[model samples]
Target chain A: MFDLEAVSAQWLGFTTEKMTAKYPVEHEPIRRHCQMVGNTNPLYLEPGYVEKTPCPPTAIPIFALPGRLPPDPKPRTTVLDIGLPVMGQGFTNMSREQEYLKPVYVGDHLAMQMRIVKLYQKPTRLDPDSLWIVTEDLITNQDDELVCLVRNTLLNFRTDEEWSATGVTKP
Target chain B: MSRQRYWEMVEVGEGMPEYQLEVTPTLIADQVSGSQDYNLMHHDRAFAQSQGAPDMYLNTGFIEAMLCRLVTDWMGDSGTLKKLGIQMRRFNTFGDKLTIKGKVTHKEMNAGEHLVYCDVWVESDREGVTVPGKATISLPSNQLNH
Candidate 1:
């Protein structure tokens, strides 16, 4: 049950070749994302309020997406699921758009690249057969500028008896 | 010391001034450990009811940082938020109470900034607009020579 035009003709225009951010913009993960969004907003908890803006353009969409931690734990893929092939387990997150051209201070160093601009396979009340994926993520820093631009809109699904009980086929 | 919002005193159906929060679980595990997105349906409510979700929810960078702290607490600290847009129809689970609303819906001035265009939302007293959004702020115009 997986042949949405040969998986969008091999991922429409697939892309994912730049991902750099081993560590740079710091300050306790932007104070743990403004204290888990309780956001005191003194331009992100006043580090002198606004003198060189210490960080808080809504912390640039959580450091422009970067996180994965678990000893040998790989199940939750992203970076637009590196090389898509849809085995659709189930996932959801319908939209997001962020643009913020510049503002991400502390130490800098951020980079990302991902693209698979769109794909829609209809029906979704949580998946009567859904598969709407749209990704963008352009974020850059460490002097290259281009601060942020995240587009994300994901929905992947699985049910046709979880796709024929994953007997897997269609490549 | 917040209080700036200028863009010539923004008006076009003005509203902005309604934000609330109360959905907890340590604010969803501090947004799943501050956005590392350990996605177990955002902290496993039995893995979000085994993916049929009836529990554990709220993550998309914590609803995009609570819709960027409800438009940066209503465009104050010299407003800039450039742009933000959201859509997730419903599912905010866990104690629910989120509020957050906005208005202004129009105002422009390109290249030189002074933007301001909103239409945010994120209701939840059980479900009303569980995240519907749009934003673009720049505001800071009192003719500072541009």
Candidate 2:
């Protein structure tokens, strides 16, 4: 049986203990990646134009911190592998709410500190045979400035028989 | 820096042009490396299939940045991207073509500041499924007098 209470309690104190990683921003690579991703705006790809703006582009900050979660060892496993009999999963990127405390240069070394901000367990509305577990991760840069906040929601389904055995409503 | 008067003559329903992106393995790899995301599912084809994913790996939060750029690009430099929200509905894999589009949905005047609200989405060309959900943004008032 999954312990909702225990899981919630564990998520409460999740923190980074000197958890850090660095990425070198090769101008060509960053620009090419931006171009390949269809972001060919002058502000991001054209260095001459970006020099005239307050921020190169929000994508620069995003590229500063790119993945779902940081690479670190923790007491609990990542939410991706949490649920059993996994049916399907998805990631809902809530937004990038931040303050550019300092300019992020091309060669700047960006570090991240991540923690589990929230977690919830709810029944799936789409499929009566499943339940959805949502987890939100808060990430910040080395300067203690907010970089990007990511919320990833994963869905898992119990077999139809499992639902019937529990006498749960199909609806 | 000369601030472009983006808000001086803006109108509702007016938006920037659309952009198309092709998802590739190298793109996904660079994103994973930059973000320190070593998840095998995003970079390993065999592992992804073993895990039931249709392809080797898919794009991550970078998609949000792409959509946000689409909005900011239309709004111009003086425009501040206040907020952007996206729900990942479907998976994007290598060889998949995606359409990044945005439209001005609402206009408002608050405390003498002109703001234009826009909605954005990223739809996959193959499945016609929107991989990212509705995004809302706030742009400066082009009507403001310097």
Candidate 3:
């Protein structure tokens, strides 16, 4: 058994500073990303497609690049860093919720910020020592408008018994 | 890609286009390169087996991309993807053919924009539903009906 308090105490309320990065919504990156997934959306492939579309060019790659996150810089704290306290040997991404607020057009710059919102432990019959780490990202276009709000929930499975000397039992 | 789908054109309960993709080593490698994800499991079979996995499997980042592809392919170029939510339930390893499907669950006019909602899911023979997702798409109105 692991010390629940020790693990919980180390990770709860642990947050990261807002880490920002500049991502340009360029045509090549957009096209390549779509191609990799075997997507044949002409709006993403054809020439002058953005201008020809019924919607504004801004909608061309709206909410694109998929959930290609965690590759980004975490600034002060890396939420996915295995080095973090109470970090587990196993990781499972349980869920993700994203809201696209504004359109991100090609040539527009994106100001992205990510931080760990909450960290807590939950008792499970399968793994009582698992920790749930939830992180959120706020992405804004160059115009300073919020483009998207993203939330990612992940489960960290830790089974090390070395840290249980405190005799913490599962709730 | 030739035809531009407009808001007035689509009907509620419409079935979006089905996307089928076979997960191959080269494709996964391409994704690893495209997403800048250098995880060994996505590329190294030996390392993955060493970690107790049956074989090298797909990464979460690629799944996200697949979800995006499912939504975007349905929305077309003119359609604005407003939201995407996905829950990864199973691991999609090599040689698995994923069939991504979705249907229009709801549609409404919000702030002069036609917002369409969809319930999306990814299935394979190995796993009935490897991933399930939801998405919101804003479409261009042809008649300008508010």
Candidate 4:
């Protein structure tokens, strides 16, 4: 029994208060991130090579997530905060859109705020009662300047239903 | 930062050099750790299986990073990623080899900013097109730098 109305009512217009990162952006994490992604772009690696340390704008989406720092983490909201009453084992990434408005540099403190944009109950061939959720995140710097805007869509559905619908044996 | 791909040099409908990457568990773990996603789907195979996923797949952040690399590597350090949009159609499971391809679709100057639009997609060996995306990059002009 999926309660579409109740779930939608709970998350609609739900936005979190701005939460600031514990520390300013550093070069070490950025370097490690670049290395892990196999990104050799000198712009993100070498500090003195460029006029300023340009944090990979793409990386900001990850950095914008909450709980990056534990042990008394700041109260930040995320798309995961929405708890649906559906019987789903997990959710999957559906899509994402990011708009970089301003450049983020090293030593800048980033603050993130997320909001639930909308939710749709669309059944898919793989699963019945597929719920699609859209979230919008605003990333700002210490100066309160908008750095980036990230909109993400996620799909949540019952694994058993998907298996049954596709007639595939569950692994 | 020194290298530059000038806006004038980019032509509409020009294909970029394809980038190939082999998907590995180590890479997936690295992405999870780097992004701090801590999502079970990205790490725990059992959890992913329980979710009806064939295997633990890459996270959204990782895919976005790959798309960013594809564009940055092509447009050089001077290029700026103004916007990026991606639609995930299939899961990029482990052991899949990915080929990232992109082409310049449009170019124009907007309010003194030289913007180049591109169509980008990642083709997975297991799944044809796992992620299709578009990017808006601002490239430096030779005149501006010189």
Best by lDDT: 4
Candidate 2 off by > 4 Å: A17-29, A48-111, A122-148, A154-171, B1-5, B24-38, B110-113, B136-138, B143-145
What is every candidate's C-alpha DockQ against the true complex, given to 2 decimals? Answer: 0.23, 0.23, 0.42, 0.52
lDDT of 2 by residue, B1-146 (tens): 22353554566677667887777766776666543445565666665554445775454546665676677667766666655666666667777787888877777766655666666777787777555444444455534444
Fnat, 2 decimals, each candidate: 0.59, 0.17, 0.46, 0.56
Model 2 in CAPRI terms: which quality? Answer: acceptable
Residue ranges of candidate 4 with Cα displaced over 4 Å: A70-77, A82-87, A161-171
True contacts kept of 2: 0.17
Off by over 4 Å in 3: A1-15, A46-77, A80-83, A123-126, A159-171, B49-52
Model 2: residue A163 alpha-carbon error in angstroms: 16
Candidate 1, A91-148: lDDT as tens digits:
7788878788887887787888888888878887656657788888788887778888
lDDT of 4 by residue, A1-171 (tens): 667788778868888889887777777767767766788878788878433857888888656655765422222225545544553655787899999999887877899988888888887754656888788889999889999999988887777655677686654
Model 2 reaches what TM-score against the true structure?
Answer: 0.67
The 10 consecutive residues of candidate 2 chain B with the worst lDDT sum are B1-10
Go through the candidates in order and give each one's C-alpha lDDT: 0.75, 0.54, 0.65, 0.79
Give the lDDT of residue A132 in candidate 1.
83
Residue B34 lDDT, candidate 3, scale 0-100 = 55
Give the interface RMSD values of the models in order: 10.4, 6.3, 5.6, 4.3
RMSD over all Cα atoms, model 2: 6.1
Error of 1 at B87 (Å): 14
Write candidate 3's Cα lDDT for A15-103 as tens digits: 54443443456666556666778756666666687434332222222323333443632111245442456444555567888776766
